[model samples]
Target: MVEIKEIEKSFGRLNVLKGVSVSIPSGKVVAVLGPNGSGKTTLIKCILGLVIPDSGNIIIGNDNVKNSWSYRKNIGYLPQIARFPENLTVNELFRMIQDLRKGYANIAEAERCKEELVSVFNIQSFLNKHLRSLSGGTRQKVNVILSLMFDPDLFIFDEPTVGLDPISCVRFKENILKQKEKGKTIVLTTHILSEVDEMADEIIFLLEGKIYYKGSPDELKLQQQEATLERAIARLLEKNDNKINNQLPGKNN
Candidate 1:
């Protein structure tokens, strides 16, 4: 459902993304895993049009994201941090969203979806609370509910399970599986490998602003002669370190 080819994004003299390319198919779950400062966030932001790429093309379905806003109607995104007007109650915030999307969302449909999401994410208990009064976990739930409010063709989540408890995290994963069964494409960034193994059909391993590898969890294991995803990643990093050391002109014993 999404295609990025030779994408490059640079911040002044520092380049964050260089010649990155990946294709995510529809109705599948794709997990992107990377260490800190790996440009995973940058890549996702580029897809959302938050950070414009210096070069390369991002295509969503048949629409070129740079050239069309129409494709945006089919996307739903949940950021790691959600910012809301502090004074608004959860109900009011949800209502405000309904008002904004009235032209695009059928009133009954949107209301039904919103109610389901609020219940699914267990946000109903905090419906009367203002954004400023809610806890981090509660706020995260609200953000997730907002993403599902549209029931769009594609769902993008960045560190979506960050603040949730175990039960809540399981529920979130189940919800993702349900969405995939309905033929919705999903792209999520996560540092949790166990969760990725359970939820992802394909894994995109991004490192230092580029795609280090992309394959199924089992395939990745085979790449490193290991039977586990964690081992595979450990081996990949060690291999990269050796490669870097080999390139140095003067080396230590």
Candidate 2:
């Protein structure tokens, strides 16, 4: 559904994404895994057209994201931190989003989806509360509801489960599975390995702005000689460290 071709981006002298390339097929759940400063967020932003790459192309379906804004209507993005107008009540905020997306989304379906999401996340009562009055978990639930209400073709969730309670977390995962079952393409970024194991069909592991590993979770575990996804990732990092150390000057002196 999305193809990134030899993308490179740098901020001042600090390079972020260097020649990164990957294709995410439709109906697949791909997990973007990386430690801090690994360019995961930057890569996602590039795809969203929020951060322009120095040189490269991002293709969403047949449309190139360059100088485009319409394609974003088909994307449901839930950022790690969503800031809403504090004065708006939850219901009012949802209504405002619906108004903003009136032409892009089917109003009837959006309303039905919002109802279902509010129920699933159990945020019906919080709907009447102001955004500033809700707790972090409540606000997170609202964010999830808003993202899924439109049933977009592509879903980009960055640390989506953060601030969600255990029950809400499980519900969120279940909702993601339901979306996958409907043949939607999903791009997920999270530090939670167990969540990746459960929902991801493919893994894109990045290190220092490059794709260090890309494959199925089980394949990664086998290649890294580890029993769990967490351990496998650790082994992969160790290999990177070893490779870097081996290249240092005067290493054998």
- Considering every candidate listed, which one attains the maximal TM-score? 2
lDDT tens string, model 2, 1-253?
A: 9999999999999999999999999999999999999999999989999999999999998889999999999999988897899999999999999999999999899999999888898888888888999998898889989889999999999889999999999999999999999999999999999999999999999999999999999999998889999999998999889889989998868
Model 2 residue 78 CA deviation (Å) reads 0.5
CA lDDT, candidate 2, residue 103: 96
> Which residue runs of candidate 1 sit more than 4 Å off their true CA positions?
none
lDDT of all predictions = 0.89, 0.94
lDDT of 1 by residue, 173-219 (tens): 89889999999999999988898889899999898999998998889
Runs in model 2 deviating more than 4 A are none
For candidate 1, what is the TM-score?
0.96
- Give the Å error, residue 57, model 1: 1.1
TM-score of each: 0.96, 0.97
lDDT of 2: 0.94
- Point out the worst 10-residue segment of candidate 1 by lDDT: 65-74
